[model samples]
Target chain A: MDRATTETKLINGYQHEFPLVPRPFQRIGESLGMDEDEVLALLRDLQDRGALARIGAVVSPRTIGTSTLAAMTVPPDRLEDVAALVSAFPEVNHNYEREHDINLWFVVAAPSENDVATVLHNIERRTGLEVIGLPMLDSYHIDLGFRLPCG
Target chain B: MNRIAPSPAIDDLDRRIVKATQSGLPLVPRPYHALAETLGVTPEQIMDRMRRLLAKGIIRRIGAVPNHYRLGYTANGMSVWDVDDAAVAETGAAMGQLDFVSHCYHRPRQLPIWPYNLFAMVHGRSREEVEAKVKKIAALLGDREDGHDILYSTRILKKTGLRLVD
Candidate 1:
C-alpha cells in the first residue's frame, strides 16, 4: 500500500479495531505488511500533523462519571469574555459557539454529581447567565469517530 | 426519569490502565511494555487488563480518532427537535438509526426559551448536505416532531476529549 492508502486505513479502518495486546503496534504492522518501526513512525508523524486526535479508548460517561450538556445565551459583546471564563473550568471540555439564541454550549464532566453541580454553579455566578443542563436522558447512537472515504 | 443500573465494577489495575491510555497509548512497538514499566507491572499484566477492559465495555473501543475536519467533514450540524415527550423514545431511536446521524441523544428540554429535547449530530462535507440529512430526520419523525432546528457550529472555542484530570 502507498502512503495515502496506509493513512486512510489508519484513520477509517483502525478507528474501531485497534488490537488489544502486549505489542499492539506489532499486530498493526503485521497486518499492514510494514515493520513495527515503520508503523510507529507513521503514527507519530500523523499525530504531529494533527490528522489523528488520539489513539485511545472512549470511556462511557455513565460508567466513569457524571456529565451534562449545558447551554447559555451570553450577550454578544460579552461572548468572548464569558466563553474564556467557562472554558477555564476543567469540567467544561467542549465549549462551542453555535448559531442559536442560546449560542454558547458546552459539556461538563465530573467524577461525581456534586462536582458537576459545583462547576455549573460557578459558571452561572461568574458569567451571570442562566446555564441550562441538557443531560442525555437516552442515547441511541454515539460513535464519535467518522470514517474517511478512501479509494 | 431514566434509572441507570449499576454497571460491573473495574478493579484497581483496570483503573490504572484506563488512566494511562485515556489520553492515548504511546505510539511505539511495545507500548504496553512501556506502560508496564511506568506502573510497576508486567507487560502481560497490562495487556490482560486492557483485554478485560475492552470486553467489559469500560473501554468502548480502542481506535484512531480521525480528525473530521482533516477528513473533509467540515460541516457539523447539531439538529435539535421538539418532539412529543410521551413518544420521544421511539422517535429518538428511529432518528438514531439513520445512516448520517453520527450521534443521537434524548435530552431534557428547557421550556419556553428552548423546546428541543432530541439532538442529533449530523456531519457532512457541506452545510447543505447536513441540512438535507436533518430534513430526512424531520421526515422520519413525521407528526411526532413538533419543531426542529439545525445549529451548525460557527466556531470551536474549545474542544477536548474526556480526561481524568487537566
Candidate 2:
C-alpha cells in the first residue's frame, strides 16, 4: 500500500468501530459507506501494517481482585535464568529491566491480595532472589487510550 | 517506515477530567454527565474536554475491560525482544499493531544478561495459542536468534490508574 492509502486506512480504523449489535461490522461499513467485507479487509490490512493492535477488552485489575508491581535485582549472569524462572508463573502481566540498580521489574495480578503474596513467595523460593513487592497504595488515573494527532 | 511521533501532553483541566475518569467510569447511559456532575461541570464541558483529550493523545482510549479468564482467554504471555537500539521503537510500534497483542512498548535494555528491549503482551484462550503467536512474532521480526522470554502472570496484586498531580 502507498503512504496515503496506509495513513487513510489507519485513521479510519482508529476512528471507526462496529456498533454494538449483531453484525456490527456491517453497521460500521454502513457508516463508512463501505461493504462489511471491505471494512474487515481494511481492519486486517491495518493490523498487517502495524497501525492498530487487537480490538479487545481492557479490564480493570482492582475490580477483578488484586495486582501489584514487583521487582528484583538479579545478578548479571543469572538474569536470563532468573527471568525464565519468574516468567514460569502465569500471574505476571508484564516485566521489564529498567535502567536502574533494581533492574528486573514485573507486574503480577491475581484474584486477591493473598494470592499475590503466595505468588511472590513462590518466586522468592524458586528463584532464590529477594522479591520486593510494591503494591499500589493509591490510584490516581489509569487509561491506555490516546488520540492520534494534537490539534 | 516513518516513526510515529510521541503524543502531546495533557493540560490542567484535561488532567482533572482524566484523574476523575481513571477508575472505571460509572456504568450508565449518561456516564459523561455523571462525571460532569462530580466535577461540578456541565456534560457538554466534560464531553468537549474528552474530545480534546482524545485528539491530544492524553488518553489512548476509552473502552470496556473484559474478564479474559472468564472469557476463556486464560493463557497470556509477555514476550520481550532484544532488538537493536536503532530498531526498538519501530519494532515495538509494529508489534503493537497485532490484534492479539494487548500491550507493547520499548524499554531500556539491561547489560550482561538482560538485553531484551521490546516488550509485547499476547493473550489467548490456551497456552498453545499464546506460544504460536509468539513464534510468529519472532519470525516476523527476523530475530530468530534473538533472546526472548515468555512471562506468564501468576497473580494480580494491584491494578489501578496512575495518579497525575497538578
Candidate 3:
C-alpha cells in the first residue's frame, strides 16, 4: 500500500478495539501487512509529527476520580493572563477560549470531588471570577464518538 | 458511554496501571511486557488488569488517539441547548446518536445567567459545517429545544488528558 493509504488504515482501523494481546503492535502489524518495528516506527513518527496524541487507552471521565467542566467570563484584555493562571493548575486539564460571554472554559480532573472543588475555588480566588461548575449529570454518547475523518 | 456510573472500585494497582498508560501505551514490540517490568508485575497480570479495566468501562478503548487539528478539523463548537429538563435524557440520547456529535452530556442549568443543560461537542472543517450540524441537533430537539448557543473555541489555551498525582 502507498504511504497515505497505510497511514489512513493505521489510524482509522485501530481507533477502537485495538489488539489486546501481549504483542499488540505485532498483532496490528500482522493485520496491516507490516512488521512490528514498522508499526512502532510509524506510530512514533505520527506522534513526533503531532498527528497522534498517543497509542494508549482513553479513560472514562469520573470513573477513577472526579472531573467537572467549568467556565469563567474573563475580560477580553485579561483573557490571556487569566487563561495562563487557570492552565497553571495541574488539576486543570483542558482549557479553551470560547466565543461567548463566558469565554474561558476548562476541565478539572482530580483524585476526588473535593479536589476538583478546591481547584475551581483556587481559580475563582486567583482570577476573581465566578466559576460555573457543570459536572456531567448524564453522558449520552457511546465513548468519545469515532473521530478523525479518512482522507 | 450511556451509563456514566461512578465506579469507586478502582484500587492502587489500577491507578498505577492508569498512570503508566494514561499518556500513551509504550510503542515497543512487547508493550504489555514493558509495562509489566516498570510496574513490578508480571506481563500476564498487566494484561489481565487491562482486560478487566476494559470490561469494566474504566478504559474506554485502547488505541490511537488522532489529533483532530492535524486532520483539518479546525472548527470546534460546544453546542449547548436549553431543553426541557424532563425531556433532556431522551433528546440528549438522540443527539448523541448522531455521528457528528462526539460528546453529549446533560449538565445542570445555572439559572438566569446560564440556562443550557444539554452540551454536545461538534467538530467540522469550518464554522459553516459545524453550524449545519448544530442545526440538525436543533431539528432533533424540536420543541424541547427551548434555547441554544454554539460556543466556538476561539483558541485552544490548553489541551491535555487527565494526570493523576501521587
Candidate 4:
C-alpha cells in the first residue's frame, strides 16, 4: 500500500465538509471529485491499517441514565484472569490499562444509579476481587473526534 | 471471476449523515423531520438510510451520550486487566453485565510498554467509593488476577466520534 495514497485519501479526506442529505456521502464524493466507492475504500483501508478504529455515534450516556470509570490493581501474573472477569459485564463500553499499579480500568453504563451499584457488586462476587466503581462526577467534554492534518 | 464481497463504499453523503447525527438526534419534537428538511430529503429517507448504516456496521450504535459530571458524579477511572485469551470472552461477558461499567473490550497486550489486555471503565462519586469496588473485583477473578492499574482521567483532552478519513 502506498503511504502517500493512504494519507492523501484518508487524512485529506477528513477535512471535507459533511453533506446534509439522505445520500450525504454521495454529495461528499461529488465535492471531492471522487465516487462514493473511492471514499469508502479509503476508510476501509484506514481501518485495515489500524489508523481508524470505527466510525460510530458518540452519544452521551448521561441523557440515558448513569455511568462511571473504575479501575483495579491485580497481581502481575493474574492480569489475564482479572481482565476476563471484568470484561464479562455487558454495561462496560470501554476498558483499557495504563502504566500503573491500579491497571485494570473499565467504563460501566447502567439504566439507573442503583444498577451501577448492583453491577459492581456482581463483579465483586464473580471475580472475588474488590471492583472499584468510579462514577463520573463531572464532564468537561465527551467528544473524542480529532482532525488529522493532510500531509 | 471469483469475487469477494467488497466493503460498502462510504460516499460523501454518508459521511455527512454520520456527522449530522453523530452528536445525537436533535432534542426537538420532530428531530428526524427537522433533519430531513435540512437535508432536502424526506424523514423516511433519513430514517431508512440510518438503518442501512447501522446494518452495514459503519455506525455501531445510535443513542444518547450522557454527561456524567453534570449528573453529580465526577471520579472516573480506566481499569485495565490482563486476562487469559481463552477466558477473556467469558470475563468480558461478566464485566459487561455490570451496569456501572460503561465500556469493556479485549485489546492485545502490547507487552513491555503495554501489558494489560482487557479493559473497562468504572465511574463513581468518590475515590474511596471507586477503590471499594476495585477491592471487590480483585477477589472475584481469583488466581487469574494479575497486575492492574487505575489511570484516572486527570484531564479529558478529547472524546468524540471517530472521523473515518482523517
Candidate 5:
C-alpha cells in the first residue's frame, strides 16, 4: 500500500480492537507489512497533526470520577472573555461555544462531586452567570467511536 | 442524575493506570511496556489489568480517537429534544441505533429556560446533511418529541479530553 492508503488503514482499522500484546505496534506493523518503527513514526505524525487524540483506552464516564455537562449564557460581547475564564479551570474540559442562549457549554470532570461543585461555583461567581448543570440521567448508547467512510 | 454502580474490582493500581493513559498511550513500539515502567509494574501485569478493565467496561475501548473535524465531519450538531418523560428511555434507545447519531443521552431539563431532555450528537460534512439527520430523529420521536433544537458548536475554545483530578 502507498502512504495515503497506509495512513487510512492505520486509522480505520485500529480505531477499536487495538492489540493488547506487549509489542502491540509490532503486531500492527506485521499485519500492515511495515516494520515496528514505521508504525510508531506514523502514529507520532498523526498525533502531531491532531488527527488522532491518542492510542489508549476511552474510559467510561462517571466510572473513575464524576462529571456534568455545564452551560452558561454569556453575553455576546463577553463571550470570548467568559469562555477563556471557563476554560481556565483544569476541571473544565471539552469547552465549546454553542449557538444558543446558553452558549458556553463545557464538561466539568473531577475525582469527586465536591471538586466538580467547587469549579462550578467558582465559575458562577467569577462570571456572574448562572451555570446550568445538565448531568446525564442515563446513557442509551453503549457503542462508541464513529465508523469512518473508507477512502 | 443516574449513578453508576462503582465496580468493586477497580483498585488504586487501576486508577494509577487511568491517570497515566487517560490522555493517550505512549507512541512507542512497546507502548504497554513503557506504561508499565511509568506505573512501576511489569508489562504482563499492565496488560493483564488493562484486559480486565476492558472486560469490566471501565474502559470503553482502547484505540485511536480520530479528530472528527479532520476526518471531514465538520457539521456537528448537538440535537436536543424534549420528549415525554415516560417515553424518553424508549425514544433515546431507538435514537442511539441510528448510524448518524454518535452519542445519545437522557439529561435533566432545566425547566422554563431549557426544556430539552434528550441529547444526540449528529455529525455530517454539511449543515444540510446534519439537519436531514435531525429530521429523521424528529420523525423517530414522532409525538414523543414535544420540542427540539440543534446546537451547533461555533468555536472550540478548549478541546482536551477528560482528565482525572488528583
Candidate 6:
C-alpha cells in the first residue's frame, strides 16, 4: 500500500480504541493484513512524518489536577504580549487565539482549585486583562479523538 | 472555582504508569514487559494496573492521536453555544454525536461578554466546511441554543497536557 493509504488506516482505525492487548501491533497488523513488524514500521514512519501525534493513553483531565477554560480579551496592540504571557504559564495548555472579541482561550490545569485560582489571578494581574475562568460544568462528550475519513 | 473530587486511588505506581504511557507505549513484541522493566515492576503487574486504569475510566482509550492539520482537515473551529442551562446535557450530547465534533463540553456561560456554555470542536477541510458543520450543530440544538459563535484558531500555541500527569 502507498503512504496515503497507510496514513488513512492508522488515523481512522487506531485514533480511538487502540487495542489494549500487550501485543497491540501484532493485532493491528493482523487486522490490516500485515505483520507486526510492518505495523510498527508504519506507525514509526507516521510519527516521523508528523501525521501521528502519539500512540498513548489520552489521560482524562482533573484526575491529577483541576482545569478550567479561560479567555482574555486584549486590545489589538497588546495581543502579542498577552498571548505570550498566557502561553508562558505551564498550566495553560491548548492556548489559542480564536476569531472573536474575547480572543485568547486556553485550559489551565493545576494541582488544586486554589492553584488554579492563583494561576488565573496571576495572569490577570500580569496581563491587566480579566481572566474569565469557565470551568466545565458537565461533560457531554469527553473523548477528543476524531477519525480521518476513509477513502 | 469548581471543587475537584479527590482520586486518591491513583497511587505512586499509577502515577508512574501514566507518566510512562502519556507519550506512548512501546511497539515491541512485549510492550508491557518494556514498561514493567522501566517502572521496576513485573509485566503482569503493569498489565493488571493498566487494565484497572482502563476500567476505571482514567484512560480514555489506548490509541493513536492524529494531527488533523496534517490529515488535510485544515480548518479547525472551536464552536461555542449559549444554550438553556437546564437543557445543555441533552443538546450537548446531540451535538457531540455529530461526526465532525471532536469534543463537546458543558462549560459555564459567563455573563456579559462571555455567554457560551456549550463548546464543540468542529473540524473540516476548509473554513466553509467547518462552518457548515457548526450549522448542523445549531440546527440540532434548535431553540435551545440562544446564540452561537465559531472561533477558528488564529494560532495554536499548545495542544498537549503534561501538568496533570507529571
Q: Candidate 5 overall Cα lDDT vs. reference?
A: 0.87
Candidate 1, Cα interface RMSD: 2.6
Q: Which candidate wins on TM-score?
A: 3
Query: What's the distance in Å from true for residue B63, model 3?
Result: 0.6
lDDT of each: 0.83, 0.59, 0.88, 0.57, 0.87, 0.80
* Model 2: per-residue Cα lDDT over A20-138, one tens digit each: 23344565557666767775666555455544444322333343346777789878788777877776676775666544556677777775678889999999998888887755432
Tell me what TM-score chain B of candidate 6 gets against the true chain B. 0.89
lDDT for each residue of candidate 4 in B79-160, tens digit (9 for 90 to 100): 7777777777667667655656656655566445557766667777777777766666666667675677766754332244
Error of 2 at B101 (Å): 1.8
lDDT of 2 by residue, B1-166 (tens): 2222332444567656766775545433346667778888887787677666555544445443333544356575767777877766567667776666766755555465457666677877687999999988888888533677777655433323332322
Candidate 2 to truth, TM? 0.54
What is candidate 6's lDDT per residue for B1-166, written digit by digit as tens? 1222455478889878887888777767778889989989998888788788877777767788877777777788889888888887788778877777777888876788788888888888999998888888877777898898888887787787544623
Against the true structure, candidate 3 reaches a TM-score of 0.97
- Ranked candidates (lDDT, high to low): 3, 5, 1, 6, 2, 4
Docking band of candidate 3: medium
Per residue, candidate 4 scores C-alpha lDDT tens digits across A1-151 of: 4655554544434432233344544555676676766656655565566455443354343433456666677676887777777666666665555446666767676656677778788887876776665553332222232333344
lDDT of 1: 0.83
Instruction: For all candidates, state DockQ relative to the true structure.
Output: 0.64, 0.05, 0.78, 0.05, 0.70, 0.60
lDDT of 5 by residue, A60-137 (tens): 888888899999989999998999998888898899999998899999998778888999999999988999899888
How far residue B20's Cα lies from its native spot in candidate 3, in Å, is 0.7
Q: How many backbone clashes does candidate 4 have?
A: 134
Tens digits of per-residue lDDT for model 6, A55-81: 888877676667889998889899888
Cα interface RMSD of each candidate: 2.6, 12.1, 1.5, 16.3, 2.2, 3.4
Q: List the residue pairs that clash in candidate 5.
A: none
Alpha-carbon shift of residue A53 in model 1 (angstroms):
0.3
TM-score of chain B of each: 0.90, 0.84, 0.95, 0.80, 0.94, 0.89
DockQ score, prediction 4: 0.05
**DockQ, cand. 6:** 0.60
TM-score of model 4 (CA atoms):
0.49
